[model samples]
Target: MKKTRIVILGAGYGGLMTVTRLQKQLNSDEAEIVIINKNEYHYETTWLHEASAGTLHHDRVRYDVTKVLNRNKVQFIQGEVLEVKAKENKVVLKDQEVSFDYLVIALGANAETFGIKGLDKYGYAITNVNAARRIREHIEYQFATYHTEEEKKDGRLTIVVAGAGFTGIEFLGELTNRIPELCKDYDIDQSKVRIVCVEASPAILPQFDRELVDYAVSLLESRGVEFHVGTAVQEAREDCVFIGKRGETPKELKANTLIWSAGVRGNAVIDNSGFENMRGRVKVNLDLRMPAFNNIFVIGDCSMIINEETNRPYPPTAQIAMQQGEVCARNIAKLIQGKTNLENFVFDDKGTVCSLGEDDAIGIVYGKKIKGTAASVMKKVVDDRALFMIGGTSLLLKKGKFNFF
Candidate 1:
């Protein structure tokens, strides 16, 4: 009797959640579970902005993936996934290939440059832990080099952030807190440093309530953050960004540091693997399985679920990914049992919270709007809750954000 082999790709939030739940749902004799990840650890994707801004250490966002797995039932494979041959039911990795009875694609996403020129070459993206570390070190290097030159280049201190989305805003919040410290360290006037956010949209945080958006904008403005709403980034260069407004010529903004937080598309492997997708995201069925293939399930950023109310796709968030993982595990278990009925995944609207530095934030939680320290506290609670969900109280206590002052 051959046990059903379940293979999960990438050890991100979705992948970990599915594996953690599946380990409990199925016995060792029933199914052989395998999880493949490029890295040996899993990092909190939500805390990436903090890591990119140098407010949080890169290692703090990650933990050993094997620590959370049940070794008796789960096998951890460390390798880069090249592609999934869906038709053949085999996954091609850099060094080896593996076949599975069930496949779960949770490969995460890549930075979406959105056809912007030179951004792929010059602009820094906060995609992963390594990318975050590189951005932090690059920013620090720019600050360190400011005084070394006899001719002071103020452009070195000017950081132009592309996109005023959640990531862009959160990163700016951390950068605002970090810049003052950096200026003090480098013996440079804080006023000389400019933190500008360029948004193509007419307003910042367009999906959020207007009042909360206004509050966020006001708070960031007070912290020396410049908001260039309705301005589009025309091009990115090695030393500057060109911006243009409606019916206006592109104006060059001289800044050595350009951090692009515009958007992210699902992993390219989706397209390469021949999955019918938009921006690399597969529109999975209500049960979280691929519409075309029942054996293959897609979760996290790699999967898209449409909102019936708004008739638009739900924004890929950590909250939704975790929820999808739970449902995916149950569905897979049902299939293995030769059951026709599978549970449908529905997202519970828990509201959203956007953090601004350590003690400032804004959000709508449980239908009520919150801001300042209260919202900030809720943000930390949210962060801790995610850890608790995947790894329980022990993991939460080990890697939780306890500083709520």
Candidate 2:
């Protein structure tokens, strides 16, 4: 009998974990495992904010895929996945095609601009390693050029961040921490630099409890970060952003940099592959497989499963993505081994930590509320834990943020 071919698309948390677990659980002769990703390295999606702020080096956020996957057990293909022909059991790539007995889609997410005007043309998003690096560089350029120009454009020194969600808040946290350093390096007065966060919601960090949210807002404000609550960005231009309150006149804020951290949708491939999806995420079955196709599995941001308690979909986080990968690998292995029983995905709520820069955070972990230094310490532990899970302690030591003081 021919060995089953198992192909996983993306080297993200979900895809990488699935490939790693399957390689260990199944006998080499039982199946041919393959992982396809656009990049040769896997990045810590959670750490992109730090990268964008230049607080952490971009190299620290990425790990070579080959370093973690066993060459003898898993085959690695570096290519962009164009589409999935699920009915034919094939995946099309720019350079080649592959057939699979079991296919996993974990291709991740892209920024959702919500049809906002000029957002696509002017706003920056902290989506990937390269994009983060570009934003960092752009910010630095603006600061450096401010001194060379005969007429000073204060807009060059102002930074406007749209959305008060996790990505936005985390990035603002880092930006607030980095501003002093930037001011010193660029010979600009610290007071002259302005950082503003505009949110459509009434409050920031909506995931946290109201008390913690208030604390976070106060902390950020104390650091000279401005919050424009209950405001929406109407448009983004090369040198300014237009925002206003509901039913109020729009006002323009001049800022060379506009970072949009509002929303994210699944990779476009899900829809392109003809799978029914809401914002490119398929409402996966209990077993993590797509309802439309038995052989196809969707994980990470591309798959949506509802929270039983709230009747709302759980926010797609790295924790859930990694867990889904483990369950996905187990089911695929069982199918290959002729096991009739398949495991359903059950997300364990370990808790969540929203870091407020290097030494501050807020979280609720293991049914206990944590904030300030304790929460920040827990956040570092969580970061290190993720590294340990995917690439072991050795990888953690090389890339982990161990400074939890």
Candidate 3:
């Protein structure tokens, strides 16, 4: 009898975790496991903001896939996924096709532009390693050319960030911290540079407690970050952004750099694969498997599950993604062993830490509120913990944030 072939897509948090666990659980003769990703290295999605702001090197956020996966048990294929022929049990890649007996879709997310005019053509998003690197380079180039350029355009130093959510706020925090260094390096006046955050919602950091939200806003304000709340960015142009307030005419703000961190949906491949999804996310069963297919599982940002207590979908995060991956691996192992019982995924609510640059942060962990240096320390601990979980102590030592004082 042929061995069961298991194919996992993408090397994000969920995909990498699943592959690592499965390799240890299943013997080489039991099943053949393969992981397909567009890039050979897996990047820490949560740390992309640091890369975008140039505060952290891009190399620090990424890891080689071969280093983590056991070559003897798992095969890693570096290729772009074009589409999934679900009905045929085949995945279409740019250059080839692969058939699988069991498939796991964890391709992750893409920025949702929300039909905003000119955004697709001009706006930059902190989506992946390459995109983050580009944003960092673009900002640096503008600063470097500020004096050399014949005309001094104040707009070149203005950065407009759309959305005030977690990703947006984190990025703004990094930018605020990096601006002073950049100004000194480029010999630009700090007063001339501006970092503005525009949010359509009535408030920013809606996910956090009201008190924490206020604290975050005040912290950002002290760092010279400006907030334009309850306003929507109607359009983005090459040299400026058009924003509108409630019952007001749209106004243009000149800015050479526009970063859109508003919202994210699942990868487009999920929709193109013909699976039933809401915003490209499949509402998976309790076991993390798609409703229509037993052999197919979905995790990370590409999968959605309603929270029983709140009656709302849980916000996709690296915390939940890693948990889901562990559950998926155990359940897959059960099926291979002819066991009937499958494990249900239960997310352990540890806490959330929102960093305000490298030194300050706010968080609610294990039901206790923390801020200032304490929260900042907790934030670094969280980062290191994630690295430790995925790649062990050695990997943590190499990529972990150790200075938590």
lDDT for 405 in candidate 3 is: 33
lDDT of 1 by residue, 198-249 (tens): 9998878876899999999999999999989899888988888899897899
Off by over 4 Å in 1: 150-152, 403-405
Candidate 3 C-alpha lDDT tens digits along 141-203: 889998887453757899999999999999988999999999999998899888899999997
* lDDT, residue 79, candidate 2: 98
* Model 1 TM-score relative to the real fold: 0.98
Question: Model 2 Cα displacement at 338 (Å)?
Answer: 0.9
lDDT of 2 by residue, 317-386 (tens): 9999999999999999999889969899999989999999989998999978899999999999999988
- Minimal lDDT window, size 10, model 1: 147-156
Query: How close is each model in CA RMSD to the real structure?
Result: 1.4, 1.5, 1.5
Q: What is the C-alpha lDDT of each candidate?
A: 0.92, 0.92, 0.92
Error of model 3, residue 310, in angstroms: 1.6
